[model samples]
Target: MDRIVRGLALSTITSSVVMAGGYKIPEQSLNSMALSAAYVAHTSGADTAYFNPANMAFMHGGKRYVEGGITLAHLPSNEFQSLPAYSGESEVEDIPIPFLHYVSEAMGDFRWGVSLVVPGGLTKRWTTPVQKAIAEEFTLKVIELNPSISYKVSDHFSVGGGVRLIYSEGVVKSNSADAYNQQLALADIARDMEGDTFELGYNLALAYKPTSDINLAVTYRSNIDLDEEGTATLYGGGDQLYHDDASVSVPLPAALNLAVSKTWNDTFTLEFNYERTFWSAYKALDFEYTGTGIVLTPFDDPIAKDWKDTNTFRVGATIEMANKITAMMGFAIDETPVPEETIGFELPDSDAKVFSMGFRYQQSEDLSWGAAFLYDSKESRSIKGMGTFHEGGAFLTTVGVAYEY
Candidate 1:
């Protein structure tokens, strides 16, 4: 019956990369593609509301706009060599994200907005009988509620601030290995995670325009300590098959980004971005005990990633054509966050490069539509653990739409 506890556990396939690898940052890469030169230009969609809320202040005709949309991501699974004899078919089934935003214009030279989005999270399945021997599957979910305000000091200089409200939920499982470990049958593990929990956190950002044709933007997102509280359901006949209350705290790391946009002429524009993720903070996963003498302890070891700060570089360009049509293209390089020592069935990550393209069409003076495509090819990484070592790489494809009212 520990099926419920197994269901509650979360599984990570390759190392966790919020945007570069795992779940792509649901933001539109095309919005940045079209207006690389405009100080207040952005993709005009629900996603823009999450990336740069201040951009809303400059809405055309000093009017407010509301929009919503979703992004779908696919990553095929592969055989993995490591501890727990898990199957190689573990991969992301499908990732769907939806969001909404509200922007207010010219608040006395200041702009304000609010955004509700799913920034980063995942659900992975390890179907191999061997892999399931260690643990069957894992799931994680996150929701962010952000409110922001910004001020324009001049046409070239601007600043902004905001607060983030985040809710996170996680579930994990494996064979009973310790006195603290929760025992469960593979079938029962899947039902426990059917439950979820929530928590809160905060963050801030800044942007600057240095010249008439170039603009730079930077942002910082803070870490969150997500605690899960829920009941574990039992599937089979057993005295201690399920628990009424169980809890755990997962550490979500923080990050920083620096980006620039340049205009060469009325027809072409370019953009570049550098991002850093502070992953060292993710040292371990803590589980809470309900009984005194001792209940069950699973993975209570010191888990540390020789993880170094990761870096990401990107370059994008846009071409403007007749009758209000625009095209987009871009490329990027991303570093892996997992250290070989800490890499496991949860996340097998490596360095990678990305290629993307998109387009926009004007439907009328007040309406428009946009679409984009992105592909990521990663370098194969060799990992040694759990008595064996194997090498593999990952590929990701993302497509999304945008609407500006």
Candidate 2:
């Protein structure tokens, strides 16, 4: 009885803000906000291993370089929803993710790189004493690893490609009594799900330099899926486990980048970049619980997302100070990919605008330090489901550092 309700509350809260868009591919956004334009500028060092691998051919110095950083973002929501049968309102848990990249420039005309990214992972827990009856808590984790290679087509044009491997796991708990008595007990069973899967895919990146002050770049990441085959453990006074081959396919949308930059002088530069996310590929998040010898089909609904593609625009400026210190600032408007009909407690997505700032300082000829901060204002989101409606907003912050040799 207790486990069933706890699972619902947990699942609802954990997936709310971060997975709000359902298909989140913002791993690159996790970096220092000042470097928002750096992907095309190739401004930093090995971080390019994840943003744009072809940039490796453009690297001037060492044959090999490694870059890594951690990001912590907080979601403080102001509005929430609660059912009479349930105990309290729904709120998200804390979120923290880490990323690393490595690239080698030598090995003939070919450049190679590997990236471990937590791009679109999420964690949101909701456990209020009053709300513990309907749902207790939920947690979800996802990870991706990519290896790539880039070949220099010419001095002015370069192309790169790679493969992606993805892994995912989750836990859901709900109150048996609240769900059974209130007629919402389908997910009342407390269950733990764990699985791992790998997919093969590739990416293409192009950079054309018309002049030293002006350059054009574009990158495209292919789509992939995670066919997770695992078992679901239901533990109570005794551990009764359900073994099934459950599969969840999350599409990695394709994207297009168009950029233009100009250098005012050695001390100042400006950059503009536009990106389009083909989010329409992410129509629905379908989890097929492959029932075993026992025909254990719980519920069935049409699995179609009907998502629309979106575009993001960013403009930034960098000012070089004395002693190799560089100051930066930028603004960006991002559109939400989640459609109104599909928006649910699992993902509460909304359109938002971001304001960011950061800096880089050269400590020595061989080493440098970078710091960046970003503030994402809350975007009002409304959800209509199960004869109920919810409206709310969310806030977030990101901080990071970079190193190069």
Candidate 3:
């Protein structure tokens, strides 16, 4: 019984929320989405504050920059095929995410900026009997507030750092009583859990321009542990088993980005970015319960995650065209951190390829607007026990406006 409860609890949280490369959403702005999150090196406009704050020092010195946008995300269902009794598909999901960024005018070689963004999250649901027993519904949401400062150290070098304030919420639900459970002779079991947390971290950035048309940048974000405390209700055989205080901790892993860009004739620019995510920080999932008279055996034990670090490569092209229009296109190759041994219904993640494109039309010297579209295509994955997962991906559309004053 304890082991069953433990396994159920672990799966509930593990399968909750994930998007790009282990639940990290790197595209937070119009330019970022248009370029498939490859805008780090040659960042411009207000978004520079979020992508590479060090670039803030290089913006036009006398004008304030502001940018705001929203993204509409559509996540298609994931299809699982295996034994006839275990085959199932997840529900499709649609969500709206908004973001804002601002950069103040330089105050003698020092500049300040701020950003509000949804850095990561996603929701997955399974209605089939077997799948629902482990992951009926799992959702995770995250918001981040970042304020940063940049210093122009020389004619060609700048440095920046920021404070990361993040808030996260999680929901997990599961149930048993289906044919599969009955076949195993397991008693009826169910669980419902909700929790939230606020955490802190930091980010650092460096930008260097060795020539008029070349830009190089590097950025690092520290990891944060979200310790969520809330209540959990467990049921067994149609009877309430335990209801009390419950807690769990998950890591918002650290990441490092290195990028470079080159411009030709001041009209065409190309950039490449390499990202490394330290998902190894996510070592385990352990839940705590404070319910009197409840036997906590395997329920209190730690479940190993053993996720590995991953690498992603991205390339983008931006063209300054006629009619004050700027066009951009990007492609990325993303790797999954979840190993086959640990993969499950909640997070059937796999390697992916991303493609994106967009255009911005300058309305005037001070205002510009545009839209971007991105598509993530996941490769089919074969899990030892779960069989094969296929037909899963995400589509995003973004509209944004930027202004200078």
**Which scores greater on lDDT, model 2 or model 3?**
3
Tell me how candidate 2 scores on lDDT.
Answer: 0.57
Q: Estimate each model's TM-score.
A: 0.78, 0.79, 0.95
lDDT tens digits, residues 257-314, model 3? 9999999999999999999998888777777887663523433556677889999999
* lDDT of candidate model 3 versus the reference: 0.85
User: Per-residue lDDT tens digits of candidate 2, residues 345-368?
Assistant: 444557767677777777776555
What order do you get sorting by lDDT, best first?
A: 3, 2, 1
For candidate 2, the 10 contiguous residues with the lowest summed lDDT are: 11-20
Question: Which model scores highest in TM-score?
Answer: 3
Q: Per-candidate RMSD vs. true structure? A: 6.2, 5.0, 2.6
Better of 1 and 3 by lDDT: 3
| Poorly placed runs, candidate 3 (over 4 Å) | 1-20, 179-187, 293-299
Rank the candidate models, highest TM-score first. Answer: 3, 2, 1
